[model samples]
Target: MKAAVIGLGVEGKKALNSLLKYGWEVYATDLNVNINLDNLPISLSSVDISPQNDKISFVKDNLSIDLGFNNQEKIDSCDAVVLSPSIWGSKIAEHYKNSGKLLCDVKTKHRDIFTIGVTGTNGKTTTVSMIKEILENAGKNVLVGGNAGGGFEGYYDLILEADKQDYDFLLVEVCDMTVGFCNHCFDFDLIALTNMGNDHMDVHGSMEGYKNSLKEFFADKIIFINNNQEYKEEFRELSRLAIEYSKTDYDLDLFGKFNKLNAGLSEAITNFISENTFEIDEKIIKNTLKNFKPVEGRLEVLKLNDCEIYIGKSDNSDAIKAILEEVDFAAVFIGTPRHNENHRLDILNEVVNANPEAIILFPGLEDTLDQAKFRLHALDYQGRIEIANNLDEIIGFVAEFSHNPSILIGGNGQENIIKIQDRLKEICDSFNHKENRLLFED
Candidate 1:
């Protein structure tokens, strides 16, 4: 069989590797010029469906890269095209579809793989990680990933590694941005929409676009939804098997009611998994999750002497809102403004509304002074808010302000989060409190 793997992002690369192992003649294409093809025949352009040698290879030909969509003629000639979820559901994709030829998805297909997709405005990564730990404790082969940044390919990488042995179940944390890119997925065996909130409406355009995306996922697969009146339509659609994810809850290793909702969904889905040949151990799930260590950099708690630190997902509006709304934090650290207007506007609004005694740290990207000023002006904060983006300068600021401050390290969209994580941890360590509590939905 010949495979035409589209896009070289994490998912596409995994799908391509899978195909290669299956002994299929694979022709990989990508718009990104930075794809490392050290051991693979990844060509630069989406020239055609046929596999070419070094002559057409971007690395060999040394052609100037063009970061654009794939070429159509090649798309038409493919035996089977493996699509990344990033492909937008527009007429372009519609035209690319050939019913007779296979249109497969790297992250989707084979619901038998068994998945628990955690969805919502926030708390997706943390809850998903809890489920993953619970499963790992239960000795189930599970991989988790989706919209919370690194969760993008993180679990898929885990899955590939587990492939050397044999893995059974997969847990995925999905975001509207990634999930919204594709209207439907054939891979989800079960789903958990944590709780809906205001986010990404700029791209989704309106409430309708956002709601419809959920509609499509439930329409395509067996789903479990948050017990809120807001998604009455979604509930109506899945009335056949609707289960309330968040209602009366217990104290959880995770943060708030939002996290409880995320965990509840995972519980229901795991129960479903139990119904099969394997009987899932409830005790294991509860125990594993009791001390479930959250991922680094997400709502990570950094302790700087006599205080528990609260770092955040840098950009996840829901996670930020949750901590702000629920936790009685000592203080909150807010990141500075960015080029992305929507992010700068929305995040600042969320931060200011949280109104925690706030100290702002700036990443200081080029060309955002005016936008930053405009955003700061728009939000009226009830808490102390200051701006300092310089690394060394912020280090000094943290030293003085580190006492009992709930450090909220927001994930990057405005600034590179990986870099932010490093800096925040370094400062936390300096205070001799290396306790970082990460909160996310993977």
Candidate 2:
């Protein structure tokens, strides 16, 4: 058997190793002209695929390498082509599919473990976490991962982890980037969609394109859709049994109405598993929903002095609006660390329209301050706007600038929001309430 692995990113490398493990002759290629393959352990004789030994060694001895370009001859000679998620829907991917080659996103390959894929523009991470906890509490062996990237292992990591251990189920947090083009290929027994928001337009190009991908993903599957979602009717036409996740007012430790919906989806899916596959105690599902805490950076609350600092994930304008609506904050701290947001200006506009008493623009890898200033000025916003020189400046301003009890912080990306959380924690630890008191305070 022969296989050609395309792209040498995290997922691509994992695919290469896994193929070689199954004794397939491998041909590796990357479009990156200067890709570093020194760490991509070619000699897997001593490779350790454990949780701790994530960074394996690499070389070019065992497989044929065609870096800087995708060699057609090499691809034609292979029986299968494993693609990185980043290259899904590309010309090469289309060619492989049209040619009747066994194309894979590395994630969709046949596996014995039962797979439950959870996907949505929002609340996916929280929902996946909820499902994992519910299953674990029921004493079921499960492996949870895929695109849940707040320091969580991804699908690639899960594949490596699956090689060493036996799991009854794999709870995968699917995203547009990971499974949009090749979802049908994944061997999922069930799928839970949290809700669709106006997000990922930058990647999916438009709402129609995004919805089409999702429709194809859920087609012919035993899927669960949030009842609150507008497209439930459309999905119901395609799914084998489209279960609706009802909204509940369960007394939850997590903040916001969205979380209630997330918990609802978790309950629906876990209950299904219990009824059909496993015997999960109803008490476990109830307790998990009632006590489940918010995932990090999703409506997370931090305290510094008298003010409540809320850290949230605001990847789009809808998310920004949701945060503003849920938390009655007097001031907002917004950043566009990635600047690649589909609606960067719209996100800033959303923050401005919230009419907070003040808005702070913190510097990031992108020039978020400039965009915020332009958008605010254009909107004729009269609220206080402060431009922070650095993360430390944000803390200093928050400490001494406002007497308001609530301060909301968020950004355009999760990784960026996590950074803000870390900085806030550090500053709060060393923060002196007395010396840096607000102007209105003593």
Candidate 3:
């Protein structure tokens, strides 16, 4: 038997690795008619085993990937064409499959290797990382990799590596895009939704559209969601295992009420697997929470001088809103307003309301929030509503307000976070606040 994998992105390499291990001759290709092998994720071993080298070919060169898949010659030689999720129902995908190339998807592993997908607007990566770390610490032999794209391969590799003695579990942080869901539909055994929020509308368009994308992918398995009005009303009778988690149920260590719910969902899933008696160690679960560090760019507290916080989250509006709730800031500086201006404004309004004394600063955000200050007008924001276009200016401003009880750096890119932290160290050294005060020292 032969397998053909297309689109040499993160998932492509994973599919290739799996097909090769199954002892099937595999051939792969991508839209990169011009991209070198180095640029593609495939290894030399996968290419050599390709049916293409054996006079039969696996991949067809569909010049443009976004539109129709036009190349049919490449699809004619394969016994089966493993469609990468990125390839939609374009003319090429339709034509290639019309030739009766057996159709299979990543979801085929439901038989022996049951799987779960973690999806949400934020914290999905960290939550997935925590789960993987916990599983590994318990020596459960697991694989964790997904949209964070941090080098973790897919189940195809894990299935081959199982060897009846090695790895057994898989944790994937699936993306919130249609392409992400289509791929997940065929790749895994079970699915988990970390939580849903108003995000990715630029790509998914409407809230209903994004939620439908979530529902379509995992319509068969369990979906773990929050006990919110929207989710409850929309998925009223969705058939699959519907689970809800909250602090009223568990004392999850993850920060925030939302994060506590993340813990709840993780616990629910862990408990389900535990019922099957998977031999997961209690120590592993504890270690996963205690040792796992939040990703660098996501709510990572940079400095904690005088209860002040400099935080970072991947330049998404939803993340900023989450961070605002997690900590108190006397002033808020956002590095970039990359998405959802209205959402970012909501975050600013909430932060200002939550911390009455907080001064709001939009250093590099420009006129995105021309909506102006809601509570404290710009003139009213003396040390607070300050704007600096350059890192030097922002750092100097941070030093100026180093006296404030607290300051927050919102957005993942705190271009001024590190520099300001270093400056604080100098001031602390000169003033000798070590004896009088400190960030967490008190």
Q: Whole-model lDDT for model 3 versus the true structure?
A: 0.55
Off by over 4 Å in 3: 1-112, 148-166, 179-187, 233-236, 248-254, 281-287, 302-304, 314-318, 337-395, 412-442
260-289, model 1: which lDDT tens digit per residue? 666676677667667764787878766665
Cα lDDT of candidate 2 equals 0.73
Model 3 Cα lDDT, one tens digit per residue, 210-230: 777765665656666667626
TM-score of each: 0.75, 0.80, 0.65
TM-score of 2: 0.80
- lDDT against the true structure, per candidate, is 0.58, 0.73, 0.55
Whose TM-score is higher: candidate 1's or candidate 3's?
1
Cα deviation of 416 in candidate 2 (Å)? 3.5
* Least accurate 10 contiguous residues by lDDT in model 1: 58-67
By lDDT, is 1 or 2 better? 2
The order by descending lDDT is 2, 1, 3
Best by lDDT: 2
Report the Cα lDDT for residue 436, model 2.
61
| Residue 437 alpha-carbon offset, candidate 3, angstroms | 14
**Any idea what lDDT model 1 has?**
0.58
